[model samples]
Target: MLLNQVPVFIFLIILSICEAKQLLDEEFGTDDVTSGLCDDFFHGTPWPLPHDSKGRGLARLCQNQIEDGKEGRIVFATMFSTTERIPVYTANTVVLHRDGKEHPRPGSKYWYRVSLALCSSDDHTFDPIESMIGHAEKHEMEQCRKFQAVTEDYTHNGLNLDRGHLSPNSINEQDLEKQLGTFTLTNAAPQFADFNREVWRVYECVAQHTILDYVPGEKVYIITGTHGVALDVNNNPWWMNGDDTDMDKNPVKIPGVYWKAFCYPGNKTHSAWGYAIVQKNENVYRKPDYNEYITLKEFNTRGIITAPFGPSCMDASFGVFSKVFENWDEYIDTKCPSYTKKKREEL
Candidate 1:
């Protein structure tokens, strides 16, 4: 009786695995990371401009409604590097928070993977968020384990890295759905827990506050990104070691730096302005300031951030010093008194 039951269990396991593979094949038929797929999020400009992503193993996913066939509004956009197993950048327009409160973060189990299969030329389509909200089965998620980082990747990882979000949940608190949407694994990167929770959190707040306070009722685009290779918990550059094949090891490149950039389109009263911050993702314990700030042009020129605000939006005319920091008055007094003096002379 025991032997007979063992064969039945073995057969059931095979059946489940096959079903998971079939569903994945049908849903993720082709690599839809083509050019101009999510241009609306970039002010109609193709991101990572000046460099074509064709054959780069990068997947441009436009995160939309989670419900299959529901076709909900786009929550945000992400350029995922399949090779790095991390997001290059996530772009989204900052929405005004109506009540000044943040939504509760969903449980860790809610995070999602965009696809199990990397790329194909077939004619089928797979929605990035289709697996969320009860659309995917337990066996289906198990299949993703083989190809991409799952919740378990960050768990017990020797580095003790946090699953840092490119598009932070706090900024999207205006809409609960959009806030919850940031939980996808494709939108995450391995970050030092101290840096992610403390330093980076403050930077995110500064970006959100600057836009909300100064440019209310207008669309302000914010882009968060990562760069460079990070060190392991023991300070070893594991990525540099070519022969390490341990699946439990860090699967993605832990970024050495994290940056955020924003663009505010000018109206009749104001000229278009933008600001960016590139901070080292080390164990620093200080609030972000103007010292870390770099002009959007410098950000692109240095190759730290490639065309972060997009080509059409980032040009010679955009002013980096138009708005200095959070407190405009304090900034004028301490940081750049000449800016206001220059403005007065021009007027």
Candidate 2:
């Protein structure tokens, strides 16, 4: 169908359907994330989804209501794993907090489940979305519970797991609707309390502050995700040996490692640069130390990360860069010493 000739509302509907087809196509997982799908949120160089050999992961364009009462503005994109009931990764360009003000958290019970009916539509020739694009109905939610994690999975389960967000709320605090978009259960994983509230939070802050402080107007794309699966205390340990999780027995897969990658696309003035960091999921009280941060080369060496920013900015390696740039004020100086020297020469 020719979309331009249709009414604006009809155009939107058709566009959404086309997007769904593109996102859910079987080959979408194998394609680079920067394949022009939701380029606005990805900054034209989105990170690729982690490998899902079982084909349980689905690509979703998360949307929320805008000022015009329309609900299709793409907030971010995620590769949600239906089997593990958590997002493998969420790729989004940071939307800085408005005027240094953070949005207050929403009331309790704000989580929503992805619409299983739409995701698992039998008429389509693509992988099922498992409802990350829309909210599921009561009956649909029940059916989804068989393969997806539900709100109840995190409640009173005797596991000290917090619903950790892949796409954090603080980065999107400027827009209430965008912040709320991060509350979906499909966008979360079972995170340890200490790790989630402590070091992981610090990592998120550093990534956000890196953009807000030094590179204020630059587009900084971030991809946060899980690496390995954690064993459930009550469930069989052998099940955790592989990527696949037994959803009926243990629906939520606590991630063994959490990682974040960020890219700053430089303009004509300077070249592009990006970094990645990883941390174990176990309890760690203090802030993340320098060694936790690594270059994209090291990230790929450790495995799971896929694709780079087209052989330029994304490919530049930080060979001997500092492990941690404690002060954001000195980030450009300490983190990018060579770049700093170049800037000094230009001055």
Candidate 3:
């Protein structure tokens, strides 16, 4: 019996290792995967954005849905760097709350999301929610590509233009559960990576730094898109009759400033679906004025633009914003990280 135990012990050890690795793949996000953590900024009350239990649960946070994305898309900042880790078995690690559940810690921001890892094997299409979001982008892009204006101008309308996601593929199921309001198509945007990577990336970074936290966790809602806005040829923020379509007519609150737009991401069905937020007060954009932060309740009355499209509309606030920070330079950074000859022409 003693002699036979060796093989059994060895097999058990290997199994343990395999299990741990599998969990890591589910919990940790890779550069290649969807990176769905903050892919969609949920609005309204907290609810579960459930999947078929295919993903490995990672982390979650409770955050505000208020946003200000008149000129740019919302922010999608990481709460904690990959180098950081929180202990779970012993005390809850760096983000343990007194209740022993993950939430409301001093420095920690709790967000609810079906945070799935970025493993190529993991597909959002496995569930209906994924399909819905996917359909919206695909269908919209199909229509967008055919539009004469889109074909003529790829930035606003072009055959090659695509929809860029603000919220990423997340691995944390708990976080998805808390979203409860952002699963609407209204909170999306059309972007080119050259633009998203350079200008949009920087603009969003500012919002994440100010409103979103990484360590413990910060719950922040975000949305992105390009619409017919009233702007000068310089891409400056402006109010226009053509830009003032439906949702842009009303004033949107970001931080302390009340701004409005004519056309943007979330102004369709709910006629107020799209919204975003950022840091820094500009003569063109807004500065944070909603005290230091905004909460879900405030977002409910002010931020959330419309109800979700499908029955699974509980956890969703993909258009929430606390501020609307916009710097064309940063916006360019997000869209055109490196200005190429083509990019120069687009501008």
RMSD in Å for model 3: 21.1
Give candidate 2 misplaced runs (Cα > 4 Å): 1-36, 43-47, 55-57, 61-70, 97-101, 116-135, 232-250, 284-286, 317-347
Q: Which residue runs of candidate 1 sit more than 4 Å off their true CA positions?
A: 1-36, 49-56, 68-71, 97-102, 112-135, 232-236, 239-250, 310-313, 316-347
RMSD of each: 15.1, 11.5, 21.1
- Looking at model 1, residue 118 earns an lDDT score of 32
> For residues 1-347, could you state the per-residue lDDT of candidate 2 as single tens digits?
55765788787999998888566456443333334455555544354656543465444544442233344566777766655666778877764632656779765456754534334542322332223345555666655565556676677555567888888886777667668778777678888887887667767766766566556656667888887766545554312213334343445677888888777767787667778888878644654565567777667777675663445545766422332354533553443333224557899
Please give the range of 10 consecutive residues that has the lowest summed lDDT in model 1.
116-125
Tens-place lDDT digits, model 3, residues 178-206? 22212211222233344444434444444
lDDT of 2 at 88: 79
Candidate 2, pairs of clashing residues: 114-131, 115-131
Question: Model 3, 105: alpha-carbon shift in Å?
Answer: 30
Which scores better on TM-score, 2 or 3? 2
Please rank every candidate by TM-score, starting with the best: 2, 1, 3
Global Cα lDDT for candidate 2: 0.62
Model 1 quality (TM-score) = 0.70
**Deviation of model 3 at 208, angstroms:** 4.0
Ranking according to lDDT, highest score first: 1, 2, 3
